[model samples]
Target: MNFLKSSVGRKVLMAITGQLMVLFVVVHLLGNSTIFIGLINSYAEHLHSLGPFVWLFRLVLLAMVLIHAFFGIQVTLENRAATPQKYAVNRTLKVSLASSSMIWTGLTLVLFIVYHLCHFTARLTSDVASYAGQVPGDVYKMVLGSFQHGLISFVYVAAMCALCLHLYHGIQSFFQTMGWNNDTSLPLISCIGRALAVIFLLGYSSIPVFILTGILS
Candidate 1:
């Protein structure tokens, strides 16, 4: 309890949660990537095969997102409150766009997450609801129908950009915060982190792009 109340502890919590979220993203991408191989329906079947446990899995996923987002907002606010007034012309010598705009990027991701849940999971909208019922339990066809649209795919790609920026800074800083990296290795870690972020961006963005371009259909 005491440790969690400390500044360093909060950062560590954020780092840990960030890693968990990253892992989830990677796993999710792999599952969603089944579309490329025509295994998406099988994948969805496996998930639905979980029976009542599907709800449990969803509850856990929801918990992960809430905990991560809660800590993220909390830490950002704390940092801003602790920071003193800065110079009129802040030096850009060491600052990067992702590092400087963590708050905004984070909030953007949060909003995207909510919309994504409603779009796919709940299938509340007319278009998505139509797809959900087009071929009962056909996750692939449903995904195909929804992503075939110009606007939906565009939003997905845009959201992925926000995710890329978040991971670029989040993953690099996570290593430093966890003491898993030293100043000498920081540059290399940053390079590796950037590569991973780009991979994720390309991997995820590819889906919607391919769908929109008639390549995946």
Candidate 2:
């Protein structure tokens, strides 16, 4: 209990959960990328074919998100308390935007996750039940229908931006926390994080951008 309560322990937990979520993000992007090759419906079908295991995996992801968010907010608060004036100084340092805004970006992602689930998974945000019926093209049609709207696509793109910024710092911190970086490796890790963030930003945002612009339709 003491170990878990310690700052180091909490940071270690954050790193673990963050890395797992990063893996999910990468895999999710790849999965989503199938749309470019016209196999998104099949991908969705494969996920659904997992039966109860799909929900089981979703539950696990949910748990991971909750844990990551909880510890993230806590650590941010602790950091702020430990250095009240640091943030004011950090504001002028453009390079530290991702690190300083971790809490805000993280909260944004939480809201996006809820709305995303409602939009795509639960289909509660629109009347797309017809496209989601027992048909092979159901998933693809539903996604296409949703992204056809300008507002929805904009929101998705914006959320991806937030996700990119969050991961930009989150990945770097993960390496630092896991003791995977020294001075010599820090630059390489930073580059890796930035590169991954850019890939995610482009990869995830492309779906909406292409659809909104009619390139994906």
Candidate 3:
């Protein structure tokens, strides 16, 4: 009850869930990278074959996503309430656009996630047109086909940009939650967070780039 009642407790819960999702992203990137290795079809089919297990994994993933989003919204609302004159207090402030615009970018990401699920996890909105009705037969082709379209590719790149903004803050917050924010270690931690954020952006963006360049077509 105390944990549910306290802001710190909610933040700790969010940090734990966020870190778990980050770990999932690392594996998801590796799994998706098979498309670059010339084994796209096999990789796609492997994912497709998970059947009930895939749904179970998805359920867990959805739970984590909801928890993270809920706490994040709560925090943002509380911040707005606590600082009614935040803009007035800093009329000339020039924060990083991404940092100041987290809510907008975050909404974009949420939409991207929904579209992504509809495209892959649900197969409700297929990218069959780009593949010329090839049907992909596996994960690689489906994913590749989705990025082959110019509009879709741009969407992915934009989403990756938003993801970079989210990670830029999220990663450091995670470390701080684990009690690693000290003067001597702050710079090192910040560097590591930036490095990881850059790697993630590049990794996720590479798929769209590869498709757009005709490298995988």
Pairs that collide, model 2: none
- Taking all chains together, each candidate's TM-score versus the true structure is 0.91, 0.92, 0.87
Give the top-scoring candidate (lDDT): 2
Model 2 lDDT tens row, 121-205: 7766764656544534577677788889888889999999999999989898998998989999999999999999989999999
Spell out the clash pairs found in candidate 3: 44-139
Question: What is the clash count of model 3?
Answer: 1
Greater lDDT among 1 and 3 belongs to 1
Show pairs that collide, candidate 1.
none
Question: Which candidate gets the maximum TM-score versus the true structure?
Answer: 2
Per-residue lDDT of 56 in model 1: 87
lDDT of each: 0.84, 0.87, 0.79
True-vs-predicted CA distance for residue 80, candidate 2, Å: 2.0
Better of 1 and 3 by TM-score: 1
Model 1 segments beyond 4 Å from truth? 88-93, 131-136
Deviation (Å) of 98 in candidate 1: 0.7
